[model samples]
Target: MFNGEISASSLQQISPVSFAYIGDAVYELYIRTNFLLPSKKISDYHHKVVEKVRAESQASYLQNLYPLLTEIELNWVRRGRNSVNKSPRRLPLQTYQQATGLETLLGYLYICDRPRLEYLLSQIKIY
Candidate 1:
């Protein structure tokens, strides 16, 4: 959905929060697409995302991704991590923020370049 409209350089104009918003959708879609079981219940699908999208969980994903991310991606993650966003309910503040940062990086890579995004996705060790 993000391949043709905006270039990666121009995406810099987008706020980190905005990136996270889109990133949330992108990652959710990816998770859904990756686990395409026709018999799965909606609750089961949501639980899967809940397991992965939580602050601590996403932070772990970011931790694992550190070695694979490029300098630019790392910069984006730092910026997203440092962004002044709201605290998510029931989650630790820093962890939620870090998750947002991870989401932002995911979103940025997604819109900036799909092939690069796919490459990054390939490196993720999903369970």
Candidate 2:
């Protein structure tokens, strides 16, 4: 398994689904970290984390973040958004697409550049 940095070109060649897979994990962890507090109940924390992890929530986030993304970042988002895939019945297709796009972009940054990923997450209000 790749436990190290991957080249940008190589990363780009990987399937968008693969990117979204890892991106999903990374983003969930990011949200969880911010919500961690001893004072908060486990159930409360779980709910808060779930709120951000939903596809609709991610889609909304992606929409608001367009102006903040760089051209390259936006390109990755577009690549993910355009990927053809079926969505879970609970969420709308557009929301799934946008969420996958955001996740793929996050995974791309997480692999290729940690600083950039941190910078992008920093731009958002994770709470």
Candidate 3:
């Protein structure tokens, strides 16, 4: 829902973790919107969304995005990757870092370049 209301410089000052916090919501919303089932199987939809939204899945998405990202986007990824100090014990640190990087990039684009974010999200190969 965020558009050009905020200036680029102001967006730059937001922390990667803050961006990721919002990005996690935004991405989950997107997945829920696009992947919802017409049937009454709520659990099925939940499982599918969980599969796609997990840290490992996000890390895979980030890996696929690397070749397509602009330098500015890559810089945001690096910022997010470097910002992680710890992760849950169940997940490898690198996977969490990469997932955070994806979230950061998504959040940045959502605020500063909505069309770009939509394009990237559409490019994702979702079942």
Candidate 4:
């Protein structure tokens, strides 16, 4: 979890760029944890799951899954997606970054001992 508190004033002072930085790692960890299921072969599973966890796939997942998120979670996703100063990659457009942010925020929440992450994952009808 991010212990660094962002006050209202400080929120304005901070940059989306910075959030994205944290968000990227957070998202990847979530994917790695979630996709590393016991049922799948390691190499084949990694190949299959990596596509879903990547920037483009995550963006698509976010779009399809957005309606299920609660208000607070949605806000976090939006903040991450809308953030500026993102590093460009060979993936799709801006949506990938946003997806990364959402994943990262979810990862952060999970690590912070938030029960909502599990709840949210459960509500996601689409795998």
Compare the candidates by lDDT and give the number of the best one: 3
The alpha-carbon deviation from the true structure for residue 96 of candidate 2, after best TM-score superposition, in angstroms, is 0.6
For model 4, how does the per-residue alpha-carbon lDDT over 23-120 read when each residue is reduced to its tens digit? 45655566567766667778876786677666667676677767777676677677766664454677555766666666655654554435666665
lDDT of 3 by residue, 1-127 (tens): 4547887788768998888887888888998888765764888889989999999999998898899899999998999999997999999999999999999999888877889999999888776
**Model 2 worst lDDT window (10 residues):** 1-10
Candidate 3, run of 10 with poorest lDDT: 1-10
Give each model's clash number: 0, 0, 0, 2
Cα RMSD to native, each candidate? Answer: 2.1, 1.8, 1.4, 4.1
List the candidates' TM-scores in order: 0.85, 0.89, 0.92, 0.61
Better-scoring candidate (TM-score), 1 or 2: 2
Q: Among all windows of ten consecutive residues in candidate 4, which has the lowest summed lDDT?
A: 104-113
Q: Please state the error at residue 80 of candidate 4 in Å.
A: 1.0
True-structure Cα RMSD, model 3: 1.4
Candidates, ranked, lDDT? 3, 2, 1, 4
Between 1 and 3, whose TM-score is larger?
3
**lDDT by residue for model 1 (1-127), tens:** 3444786577768998888888888887887777667668888888887776667888888888899888999998988988855686787778887788889998887777778888877777768
- Give the clashing pairs for model 3: none
Write down the lDDT of every candidate, Cα atoms only: 0.81, 0.87, 0.88, 0.61
Clashing pairs in 1: none
In terms of TM-score, the best-performing candidate is 3
On residues 81-127, what C-alpha lDDT tens digit does candidate 2 reach at each position?
A: 88847899997888899999999999888877789899888877765
